[model samples]
Target: MSLTWRISLKSDEAEGPEDYFSSSLGIIFPDDITNQHGDAEHSLIYTSPHLSKSLLIDLADPVKEDDRKLFSHYLWNASLLLAEFVESDSLGVPLDNPRAAQESLSFDVKGLDTLELGAGTALPSIMGGLLGARRVVVTDYPAEPVLKTLRTNVVRNLQPAISPAGSSTTPADSVLVEGHSWGELEDSFSTTHRHSFDRIIVADCLWMPWQHANLHRSIAFFLREAADARCWVVAGFHTGREKMRSFYDADALREVGLEIEHVWERDCNGVERPWDTEREDDVTERKRWLVVAALKWIQIP
Candidate 1:
């Protein structure tokens, strides 16, 4: 399903052009999964296209008054796209993005330490684990309700092979569910896991302009200081392209010693094209394209 929208920034000026800009961009989270089940607590079983194993992810109610708006409980389309790409890359299955300029895109996390930021349902992280990533750290906002759901998803899908961070018997490939608030530098998660991950996945996290700096900081700080280390980013334009463009064009990522290696536009149908800023912002068409990119740490002299 295409997560498309034309948001009106002003309450009183609803009749005017919907393009008027504002900080509070209306983000629509499309619940594309129809197989969701359970009454009191909802859950969905996801089966990857490339991988044989299936993941059972529990959904937390975000509308509850006291839950602090835990919207990360649901799986977004970008997450699924990223997961599909990674699984294809991991299994050496060639991606069928004919419109892509690079001809071929290479990504595989096998035997590497992987980390996922804003990992709501952790689909990508689960793919990394199943694909033989040396370690997979799944993290999200440090709230208990958010972390609880994240933990449940990770444990239920990857346990026996998964354990908490402090486990003495934790193996090299164990999936660890962690609580991480973006840009919290002095916290335990920051201190213990800095410059650690080889492969970092950031999915559907650039919607909030207010959180871009924090997200960039966390990405730069955690991504390993190596020539091969990369951060894979997948974001949708449901919040509006202008708001999404601000995060990339602000030079904030480059300022932090990270550089965009490559980026492309892939629609929901698995068709890919070169990233074009000059393209028309068709509200209906924009939802079909999800911007996918790879960022690597700048090598110092």
Candidate 2:
């Protein structure tokens, strides 16, 4: 359960869970959960080793705060691109070549640590565990009702396979869910969680340009300063680029002392990123699109 691809549906039909699950591309929803209103929150947690069925966790109707519109309850296209990049042999960033560096990482994880910021369904964080991260902390805003769904999905996704009576389950300590409000570091996080992660994932969280400064403060505190540590990011303007211009710019990241190493832009459709062929003009067919990047802390002289 390392990758999460959410497909939200609005259904006028009051079909049972079975019908809903069957209609999905892959992954099935849990039995007995009823749809809320006309909206059904369905997500497919893609398994590792291949693009096969893993687990399905149905999320409850999300209640987004007025100021947090971009942090909307629905899943954005960014998560899909993020998952593909993490699993692709290319690792998407040709300049930095993240895949090459990741291959050097031991599958056993050992001392590796990962964290996912604004993890709506927390698909990337879960992928980190499957990819051999020693510890993965999935965090989002402190919304109790919403956090309940986040916590449930993590447990449901990470649950070990049906084992023999004598056997144990996937190490429980591998992942933890937390409610973290950005900008208020000292009040929300402790030194134990600070500068501890070897890899960090922030996907589809940059909707509020006003909060970019606060987000940087949180990233600076939590991001490890080690030479090899990197924070992988995928972002886009689903609501429109004008809504969140700062996240697409370099000034905010530079102010936080983070050095941008690689970046790639893709249209919303699922085309092979970093196109294998000559540059095509049709790539810009979509006015709204997604952007992915690999960033690291800028070491001081």
Candidate 3:
């Protein structure tokens, strides 16, 4: 027997202005099924009016099958979520060129040496590579299966070449995948790429209040030396207002010398709101909003 699931984009009837909204389609198997091998056996198909693509990811259980299963599940969920965001076209306004919310935040990516922290599935980093960035490094935690999956996605999605300005000149070559953790930022920076990236991009990385200090410290340590460095942290707040308050009060960002310059909201289409009055207590059904914060280093000139 096969199961089919649909993630609806329309939260309510009042439609907003965008042709398509981004969403992810997730597939899960019954827990009793122990023969599960990897993500490659499962097929994920993504379709939009403008873009349609299907990818098959393999799951290799080198040591523990259970670990592989858990990792695969997370990747599948993450990919679907990212797909929804990209398809919805509500990620953010294009700062430089017409690109996805993650890509657009990089301000054209042209000639910029960039790094994407906690880049699950590496969409923004891939976009940076597509946009002719001088060098694009996609980093996540040092988890084995996660890193493997990240590398696989990078190779699967890499374009033949990047045409800067859509010109016919030599195509730009950028490295795609790497590993770094907020906890290991100091060592990672000292060993590899050492004080390099001009722009650091982070999306949906501030969900957990506990990660604030380490994340801010990593950003500060790694990005402290760029001549004109900027860290763009984009967070989509679906958790709740209390978590947001906690995150703010942590002052992790202040300890690292970064300040939020502006806060704004973007109206997105295809978002769905459940009408389940009975499940009001369910945190998942609570109303959610998208929040963007533009951060820059405190200049003392």
Which candidate has the top score in TM-score?
1
Off by over 4 Å in 2: 1-53, 63-72, 89-111, 162-170, 268-288
All models, RMSD in angstroms: 9.6, 8.0, 10.2
- Give lDDT per model, in order: 0.69, 0.57, 0.48
Q: Quote each prediction's TM-score.
A: 0.78, 0.69, 0.61
lDDT of 3 by residue, 190-261 (tens): 466655777777766665667777777777666647435776654443454444544443266676676665
Model 2 over residues 1-301: C-alpha lDDT tens digits?
Answer: 2122233343435268665654552444322112111122544334343423364544445555542443435455566556555444222222222333234432222247878788876766554454445677888887765577678777876554521122233356868888788777775454569888877788877767787787777777788888777777777544455545565456777888887666656554342254111233332232335556677787831
Give the distance in Å from residue 7's predicted Cα in candidate 1 to where it truly belongs: 27
Colliding pairs, model 2: 2-126, 2-127
Candidates sorted on lDDT, descending: 1, 2, 3
Q: What is the lDDT for 158 in model 1?
A: 63
Give the 10-residue window scoring lowest on summed lDDT in candidate 3.
Answer: 29-38
Residues forming the 10-long window of minimal summed lDDT in candidate 2: 30-39
Point to the candidate with the largest lDDT.
1
